[model samples]
Target: MASQPADVDPAEFNSLNEDFYRADPAETIEHRLWMLAAFLADESTNVGGQEELSLSRDEAPYRKDRVQFAALESTLILHQAAETLLRLCLAHWTDAPCPWFEMAKLRQPRVFPKKVAHVSNTLDTDETISELLRIVSWSGDQDVIEAGVKWGYENGWERHREGLRELIRYCCVVIRDGADLYNAGKHGLAILPSEKGVSIGEGDVISVRGPSLTVIERQVQDGDLRWAKVTHWVKYKESIAITGKIASAVRSLWECGKTAGLVVAT
Candidate 1:
């Protein structure tokens, strides 16, 4: 009798291949952006509900840390979605071979600026390249383009050079700022720092988690009698707004791209 191999589940394995790695590039980008947006929106809702809960009744200090961590995670998601969208836009609209690769290398911000700048040269002749560069500058101003070019090897025209520069700026802010915070959080800076620490007082509730503590204090003067303790809680409302903005911006960009006939043929 032939024994059935436990690890060989043909039906399950086939189902995984159906949509996991077979999505068309264009559709995949769009779908991923929407999926990230939905996740961020859910996080926003959770944070809001948590805030309301805190307001209605006394929430354990740990609740604040959990809500803030969720917000930070949402920020990280928004940043990733923004960068992916930029690369996708270039791939869809640019004439350069390997547009996505060029865009990724160009936006490195630390290394390969020179390499990225030369990417524009791959588009067309100097005249078309110049025009494309001009058009892609966040502002249509020559000085702005020149400044961008001077600041880094970024010629700003990776994709045959047609894009919504204003929208690009909006998206960049979210991605860049969120990236800094996200990196910091990932590297053991998850707890936001405060100038003053909460002092444990009689009858005051204190809940401490790993790197996260509940503290409520405005400022501590020298020689204060109360003991100062650090907290891991963070204010999440601002983060929530930023994530929502990023999601909205991506949706708007997608709509604009569709109107401009940037869909991939099935």
Candidate 2:
């Protein structure tokens, strides 16, 4: 039903289609990473105190709302970037044809390592995390490594797999722990700026005072009821840390892709 335009030759169009099929995977991954870097840069500029703000009492609420909006959007962008990194990692490990589309159906972080495991018998989720951490050479930074170790110690993660697991759990995985807010933002738009607190006595209370956010989800058994589940405490510092980790991982992947391409060329 479609015909080539008079000005365009059929042979040239067919050659273009062939070129598409023969496109370089490494170059494709680089382009995706470049776009992701642009998104991250934009998010950073908006949330990194670069924007002017009024300190007047009358404009306090407006300033607070603007900060909350930036936090929410930045969190979403970081999560999406993590997923993109996971997909790129899978593609690099598998070296499969049309991997972008082939792995498009996999949306869960847990499943990504499992898919990689299929390609390699010994590389499980933890090993995959370790590989990524090693590639990034995060151990060279004393401050970063110490922070990861401190977090792992506080959270009861094993010393053997502490730093590796921490990176995967915090910056990479997005199913259970760091996922509810992202899912809520994407699906129901049920995130709200709130405080996390607990009642102690009739008139007393213990509260974790901070600028935080909560995600509300519909009750599974009772669809009519909405459950205010406190998911993330929305720390901008933590978001920035996670973004840095993702950026490091992306850079490592770019280098690895280039090395792999060179190997194949020889």
Candidate 3:
């Protein structure tokens, strides 16, 4: 950023920011409205050096976007105006997380807005481009944002990739990758006791026999034997069809057990 005029003091900035934060939302936004006016007062803050941008006009698209993305009240609307448009969002300028990204960390949904709540965290310099890609925000240009996030994550923002991935998932980016690993074939699979009987952890594959439905639940127990959680497991689409086959298998087990004089639960 270019240096401010010598007359423009920096010491008052903290007080200005504090007052801005404490002001009623309207007053806070009014202050930003004035800042926009000031930013556009210079011809440089516009599409061309010949024209000064008009917030009332040019800013309307971004304002609408912010309203949808953050659900900003009338008072806090200026913050979004200043951050997304007044700052680095210009096509010719460098893009970076705004300084207030830290402020968003200390504030509430009101400050950061709930829709893009993922970006409210304090973003460090080390945060990779990939990490930023995972943040969920409403850009009218979803495709552009998605590409930016993906590029951000894969490039310098490695640490933030998971977070951005989570945001992308939250936004329903489609075709998530990790749902097929745990499945039970036939009687479907159930979390049953291992031959040795230790609890299974995530990603451990265990064989379950006679499961009317393959249940990928937390390990449970029946008498001395452990069973997987019966009520809360995800049923795989393809393998779930085996439930009927397992039911027939169970009936055969019941008949054979009874013929052998073995007791069976109802």
- Residue 2 of model 3, lDDT score: 71
Clash statistics: count for each candidate: 1, 0, 16
Q: Candidate 2 at residue 139, lDDT? A: 34
- The TM-score of predicted model 1 comes to 0.36
By lDDT, who's the top model here? Answer: 2
- As for candidate 2, its clashing pairs are none
On TM-score, the leading prediction is 2
Tens digits of per-residue lDDT for model 3, 1-266? 67633432445444434443332322434454444444434343233423354334432234323322221121123223223321111111122122223343424434323323333333322342233332223222345445655553343343334444442233221111111112322124322322122235565566332212123533435645554434222222222222222222223222322232122223
CA-RMSD of model 1 = 14.8
Candidate 2 on 25-78: residue-level lDDT in tens? Answer: 444444544444444445332343323544334222344555566467667767
Q: Is 1 or 3 the stronger prediction by lDDT?
A: 1
Model 1 residue pairs with clashes: 213-232
TM-scores, all models, native as reference: 0.36, 0.52, 0.17
* Candidate 2: residue 161 Cα off by (Å): 9.2
